[model samples]
Target: MTFNAVTFTVFLVLIAVVTVMGFVASRWRRAKQADRLDEWALGGRTFGPFVTWFLLGGDLYSAYTLIAVPAAIFSMGAFGFYAVPNAIVLYALGFLFLPKLVSLAHKKGYVTLTDFVNDRFGSKALSLAITITGLLATLPYLALQLVGLEVVFGALGIGGSGSWFVRDLPLLIAFGVLAAYTYSAGLRAPALIAFVKDGLTYLVVIAAVIWVPIKLGGFGEIFRKGGAALAGKTTSTLDPAIAVNPSVYLTLALGSGMAFFLYPHAITGVFASRGAKTVRRNMSVLPIYTVLLGFVALLGMMALAMGVKPHDGNPQYAVPQLLSAVFPPWLTGVAYAAIAMSALVPAAIMAIAAGNLVSRNLYRQYRTKPVSAKSETLVSKVVSVLVKVGALVFVLTLDAKFALNFQLLGGIWILQTLPTVLFGLFTKRFADRRALLAGLLVSVVYGTWAAYQVKSATGGPFGGSTAKPFFLDSPIYIAISALALNFAVVVLGSVLARALGAHPRAAGVAEEPVAASN
Candidate 1:
């Protein structure tokens, strides 16, 4: 794709607008103690429903999701919708269970998910387990966002020449802009820019849903052509008509939904909310993004109907190419900018959330010396920078396809923490800290191996998220399969710990009272 001056100009203008917005975010909801961890890391835990609606929307439904979902649908067919059903269970869990955690967080002044784990179970080891898992899972997911931004760069013809440094110079500048605003404004930067990212996304997707199908000769023609093009060679259910191997669909959706909120950014958004009402409000409306996602996913089929060819056979380019082909240079710029901003908002939030986990849970939790709030915030801020640099390495060194699996790989690792972080929120039944630790350890090992066993046609081991289980006839998501194993271990361990008179060791931290818990 050759460069278009109009598209590039419009895209840069929009990006400049948001870059300024990000720097200004520090004052949007300015707190009394701006340098403190809670204020800088969490937006002072004062977000209301409106800001949070876009914030969570921007955080969870990111450039990686927007680009990858459509790319999957474009290349593989209806199987790509597997990532969509996650929203149903995600919001249901959010509406029912998340508010409970929110209330607890409000009472306890918890900034990180590990903060709650440490307080509830009285175990710093359990907290560190969650912290390590959060960091490991988040770094790759963050790198995947750059993959999305790089797509926009390709569409604009901005790079792909000169030395490695020259080819990626645009991305480096983007990183610089993102790092600047994020370091300046912290969580507020993303919270503010989310409005722009999400608004432009909705605008572009709304246009594509209506316009792209029309160009493709309507939904009927799209399905007719798409149906014929998408037939599978085996029982993989590549066609829209066949939903065979429904177990794969069900389990992936369930696992993804279960793991969605376990992400550090998700929990950070929740804690930033001023109250449970804000969370419930955000949850009720968050599915708006999913609805948009369904439409975005349809672009793949639309591309098929129009016989849109991918550049270099990379399906990830499907949406960008389609947008550039169908829309004028001006709207193409808007669409490209939307996708690029999508990466920045979530990346900023993820870095801040990971930084919170490190400074609060990992480093601060075990420090022999006292650390001031400002110093702790400083530590987190620095960690946030280093975290993105590490993510850059993942992007520069590895195949983006493998990097794509990093989120799934992260999920396999992150899901291991569910039994420790989320389960304890409900009942003390799974509250045995030693049992929880063992569950986390065992699940990480098993999940990694399970995912490693998956060999893709193109991507090697860790090639895909779904694979045939040893006992199951159909392939299942490693996160779900491994989570079952995680739950079993913890339940059995909890029972044995009970019978053996072992208990959760108290960490001697005083608790603040809120709503009652079991």
Candidate 2:
């Protein structure tokens, strides 16, 4: 499937134009303020309802959704539908908690979720813990976006050889643009370009649904062929390890639902909104994509009907393979561009979110006078570049299969921060510092052990399972479970210390006002 030079030219031109538009959106400020962290990092916290919708949606449904979800469906059957419901569960979770978070962020001028945790827990150590957890968890997430773009570029055959430099040139170019605009414009750049990303994605997915059936025989016949290909099973529903019974379904769904909004990158999107109304309105309307997600998942069945095979070394290419077969050379190039740009937008946002954690928490952890707004933003920008470059190395040099597993492991590790964060949002009773550290350690150890046990047969990729008796395969998402352990230890340690009459000084009381920083 060779894309003509004209199609390639149009695709590059489209990306160039959107890149300029993204940089231009940095000027969407409400005031003339130039030095505040809010203005530079959170888009001045002034994104209206529509802008907020696109930004949050783009940030959430990223390259992972564009490529990974459909690919999952293509390879594994109904197990891929987990993405659709995961999205639904996310919105439902967001609806319940985001309004209160928006109100608190507005009143308190909170830029990152760590700000809220630090304030609520009165423990700088715990805040720092959550901050590091977020930044670490986002590494593979950012890499997943790069992997998505790599899939698109490979489909276009942009780089002819499988050589390290050649295969990754498209990733390098996409990352360069992403880093530049994200550095120059901050969150507003991605928030603005999300409009284009979402629009093109919608167009591409809709065309796939409407055109694919006609291109083949019809929906029923397509499934019939798919079923025959898969031994009379059109779509194998549910994962046996994780989705066995009603209890497994409920636990996986509810646990992920709780953890989804708890991620710091997820909070970055929430804070990007101008106000509570913007957040609320977007929450109500974002579920419209459930229909599109359903369509994308069904593409797996289409791939099965068409007997699509995974691309060389990247299982994520199944969706692009199906599309390239269906569309003309010109439109195929357009879809490839959409997928490439899809990864770029989220990779930029994740890099920025992770950088905010380091610049705000780790860099100034020991500073007394406190870091200035300009210094803080500068640290964030520098770290953002370094993180992307690091992820790029992983994409180009390392095995993506292992990298995907590591990302799943990160989910487990990050989930450990949930208790100190989400419950801390409305209460301060459980702010026991020692207990928090203990819980993080316990969950990290257990999750890592479980992930490591997943060794595959024939000395290939590990494929044992994420479940451990009572747990499921998504063990990285057990942050809430880890939080329970953390709280128990904190309570016991706090009690023993009280009996011995030992106590650490209360922290964060002498910090400057939140509004002052902004």
lDDT per prediction?
0.82, 0.72
lDDT of 1 by residue, 306-339 (tens): 7777777788888899899899999999999999
**Candidate 1 C-alpha error for residue 229, in Å:** 2.8
**Per-residue lDDT tens digits of candidate 2, residues 348-382?**
88888888888777776566877888888888889
Model 2, residue 339: distance off in Å is 1.0
TM-score of each: 0.94, 0.88
Please give the lDDT score for candidate 2.
0.72
- Model 2, residue 101: displacement in angstroms? 1.9
Model 1 global lDDT (CA atoms, 0 to 1):
0.82
Task: Specify the poorest-scoring 10-residue window by lDDT in model 2.
Answer: 509-518
